[model samples]
Target: MESVVGNGCFRLVREMANIQGRDVFVADLYVTPTWLDPGNTDPLLHFPKDADQKDALIIPLWIPGHFLLSVMRPLQKEIFFLDSLYFRRADGFSSQAYRELLRGLAQQIVAGAWTEKTALDLKDVPKQTHGNDCGVFMIMYAWYFAMDACFDFGVDDMCLLRRWWCIVLLENFGLEGYGRKFAHFTDEGKATLRDNVPPVFRITRKRKLESPMVSEDLIQYPSLQPV
Candidate 1:
């Protein structure tokens, strides 16, 4: 579970080029632990000095068994806290403490001080119906926001979303014969997935899959292909 959350964050950063004309800066997950450490006053040290200049920053928060998303829009002087579970209290830290920490981080990044308060607010983002969907929600939150699109997805859409996410990752990493794996999807379903795809991804050009070597491997995971 922890690995899934970490991979989600990694994929977001690795596939960031899929979002056209966006310069979202994502901090390393390792810095999260340092931020959570109460004794660490210079938690931002792990972040690049110029991170504050980016249009948006995505930070993944993990507390033992849960994950959450924190976005800082420095230009707008606002920090948006998104939790799929909507828990009043997260696993390892009090909501107030976390909120204060976020606010302080935003202030330092944007205003370079703790005296100025930015518009820190918890957004009513989409929620997950199942307990295990938090990691998916975190990745989706980063993906949608980075693309400058609203997240209209919910728990029910996760299965399909997960498939699309896999396709995107595979495509980004230049895995061969990716198109062959989803040959059964109707043009409409394919179009829907394409429409939701970030503009930077060039999936319109069809690449012929000439080899059948990986066909069996793909066949075993038909559920991961779009229906």
Candidate 2:
């Protein structure tokens, strides 16, 4: 069988099939750049300073929604959704537990009940790269994916914040397209990224919800600050 690699939900699918990269030429669909000619130089995908090339793919899938982005807002205008704090312990963090904390804190931040320090802590993890860069991961990815799944999802205020903050974080990291900019890429750079997608990549169409539903916990209050 040809080895096929998958991102997000693709991991489960690939695992079931026992595909390996060498056999199938597996690659992540979202992060690959199509325009890099391999002959020409493009700084966009350059590895960070002092970073090992082998260690580059160590991306975390945990994004703390607006909990980190809210505090990092003023400094950078674009935040990549891939930015995340990585814990490489043999016995490591629980994804469920961390996601619960992020959700709870995001709710509090929206409610205007979160303290300034709490916001800082969420945004300012010590081992972060990019100097004070607050990495966003899965939680943020889920929110963004929801917006892509529906227009109504994009119009919601919480969704707007998520998008805006993501943009800011990316810009801060000296990359283009975080939120709105990122969406535009879906059209502009779509050809490039799509073309670059490994041939073995499988496209999965998501079922759209019939009704525009905002998470009950995402309800907006009068006191919520303009994002």
Candidate 3:
């Protein structure tokens, strides 16, 4: 199936425009739910690019309403539950299905891999005390997780994070760099992360988030927003 460039999470997915062809998948609830459906004739068209040649796949899932996320790293043979609220895998409907789907994805990417499947229980991940920052948190978490970048963001970093998001989107709206580079999947990643620093972008957020990413999440499903 030819992959469509769809990158989404929630309200941004009604038309189901998610990013693909880079092993990064971020689809909306209703649309991507079809991927897990047994009757789907071509589920791969949803996301998770050409798995045959890619080094890894990163799937950042958003549990609707609350929008918390679980990152599926198929190549690493593991899935990371990055819940700002510290929610458990079994705490929600979508989270529960993600584990099994990840295993399926692992098998598709590499047979018999990721067999010891388990969401690596992480305790030090930054949490959102009480705010609508879950989506923002998911975006940052996926970037740091996907790029294997340092985890320096905290509750105090939210304002900066939001502002940074704004700048990046404003500047990158017309860029064509999506699915081209993914050092984030490499053992010795060469991808440079600038989120830790101040913003130098065209400036662009608020109002359900207007992510200026090229597309795809766990593309933070850097699948941050729709095109």
Candidate 4:
């Protein structure tokens, strides 16, 4: 499979795009159910660029809706950007155990190692409450974006199985926990968390850690608007 230039996530999407020869959208949050229509473009093709990087323009589709639904919006709030699944090295604050485990899990999924039931078992790894619907849509949107972007991966590369494992590992290290602990209502994390559970084997109100990120600021990328 192809790897994007800047980060693995970017590379993964780009590679898919290169192979598929299509556009990609990376929504920062969950788009409302009716948000994608003739007046709007696909939610996955827009992304903003950093001064040091050069990627195709990506738009942020911020969903404007009801409070409960908005809470379910993935890109409707601020968020921390970390593609922990494709960590390039062993250094940094990441836990080696979690990294190794997630990498193996991703590999297994790519190899078609698990079943839908197993994948669903790990689906709610982080056990979240606020972003339940948003999380589901985020994963769906990411995969949709990746697929439409036309990268090199197959059903396995960025499949739900791989994504589930990614969330499992993410929760193990409390990465999402910290975000939840201090996140605000409009914050992707809701301003603070009082619970932490295993991503793969837990049941609680909070959304799973491996779930797609929900942040409004990330949606600020201007290219996300319908063209």
Top-lDDT structure, candidate number: 1
Using TM-score as the measure, the top candidate is 1
TM-scores of the candidates are 0.62, 0.16, 0.54, 0.21
User: Which ten contiguous residues of candidate 1 have the minimum total lDDT?
Assistant: 113-122
Alpha-carbon deviation at 17 in model 3, angstroms: 21
Better of 2 and 3 by TM-score: 3
lDDT of each residue in 126-215, candidate 2, tens digit only: 223333223223333323322222212211244454465545434333333322223323332344455643333346989987998789
Each candidate: what lDDT?
0.62, 0.30, 0.49, 0.31
When sorted by lDDT, best at the front, the candidate numbers are 1, 3, 4, 2
Regions of model 1 farther than 4 Å from truth: 4-19, 38-41, 87-94, 112-124, 174-227
Estimate the TM-score for candidate 1: 0.62
Question: Per-residue error at 125 for model 2, in Å?
Answer: 18
Candidate 3: which stretches are off by over 4 Å? 1-31, 36-42, 47-49, 52-55, 87-94, 113-120, 174-227
1 against 3, candidate with superior lDDT = 1
- Candidate 4: where is the Cα deviation over 4 Å? 1-11, 23-133, 149-227
Tens-digit lDDT string for candidate 1 (1-227): 45544564465553453446667777666567566665555657756788777777777776667777777777766566767766443432224556678787787787753332211233445776575877788777777767767658888898897787676545443345444334333343365466753333446878898865766555665356665
Clashes of 2: 18
Root-mean-square deviation of Cα positions for candidate 2 versus the true structure, in angstroms = 25.6
Task: Score residue 185 of candidate 3 by CA lDDT.
Answer: 32
